[model samples]
Target: MQDEAFFDETEQLEEASSAPTDTAARKRAWRLRINYRFIVQHTPYILFLSGLALVYIANIHYTEKKIWDINRLDKEIRELKWDYISRKSDLMYNSKMSEVSDKVSGQGLKPLNTPPQKIEVEKK
Candidate 1:
């Protein structure tokens, strides 16, 4: 009877291995059933990891946006500095006496031709 049971078990094993498609289908069904169990067991951990991933992704995007804004502001600051320097130099050039005289010359305002002497008064 033991030998017959062993033979029957071996025959069942042989039948199970005989069809690859059937074995694969059984494996697929088993995996599908286990997938539900896996999710049920680890759902909280999965949700925690998902939240961490979202925070990580959002932090990366926020940092990148901040860096982009910093770069843009740096570029604008450089341009403004250049403009300030240019305007200051232009103001200095226009403030010179020669340029002032030239601008006023067109308005019929002439520069002094000679230096004047101060008069000395004696108390009597």
Candidate 2:
């Protein structure tokens, strides 16, 4: 019985060797190196790694967005500072005694040329 089974296996091997060497057929005959048990056991670790990678990517994006916002805010602050300086200078120039007289002159107002005399009243 052993000799007959071995002889039949050799014959099958010879028949397969004589068969056409089709690349498509060979590709379809691929075998797994890992077992299903190992895959199922390590699935939780794979999912954890995937979750960590996603969190890392999200953190990078959030950091980049914060950097962009900081740059934008820096530009806005610079512009506002310049505006503040210019407005302050304009206010200083416009609040001078000369400018105040000039503006009020159009409305028929004039500056006093002499000091006013003080009068003392006695209470009776």
Candidate 3:
């Protein structure tokens, strides 16, 4: 009986020493699992924010290009409008009916000496 009790006490001491190692291993595993879960839960949000930032940068670039294009087109349209207005004024000033008639007369056209006879139309 004395030998058996000594053997049992040795076994209990061995188990006590090993207990802390098992507990430490279990705690390490639990920590790893929690870290993995944290990474998994937030990974998609991180990727989504990164994608949104890239899209916002691209949109800013596109809008800046469009604004420059609009400004260039507006300047071109103003230049064209000014050219059109100047040309229209020149045409109106240079091409008078009296001058046209004088040119026609110079090309052997004579004015009518008599008045034209009037015709009446009846509408039903």
What lDDT does each candidate get?
Answer: 0.95, 0.88, 0.91
Instruction: Judge candidate 2 against the unseen true structure and give its global Cα lDDT, from 0 to 1.
Output: 0.88
Off by over 4 Å in 3: 1-41, 97-124
Better-scoring candidate (lDDT), 2 or 3: 3
- On the 0 to 100 scale, the lDDT of residue 73 in model 3 is 100
Residue range 1-124, candidate 3, lDDT tens digits: 9999999999999999999999999999989887998679889998999999999999999999999999999999999999999999988876887666676887898667799989999999
Tens-digit per-residue lDDT, 17-57, candidate 1: 88788889889999987899888989999999999999999
TM-score of each: 0.67, 0.63, 0.49
- For model 1, the run of ten residues with the poorest summed lDDT: 15-24
In model 1, the Cα lDDT at residue 112 comes to 83
- Residue-level error in angstroms, candidate 3, position 41: 5.6
Model 3 residue 91 distance off true place after TM-score fit, in angstroms: 0.9
- Pairwise lDDT winner, candidates 1 and 3: 1
lDDT of 1: 0.95
Pairs that clash in candidate 1: none
- Which ranges in model 2 have alpha carbons more than 4 Å from their true place? 1-31, 35-38, 116-124
Deviation in Å, model 1, residue 119 alpha carbon: 13
Best by TM-score: 1
Candidate 3 TM-score, C-alpha based: 0.49
Better TM-score candidate (1, 3): 1
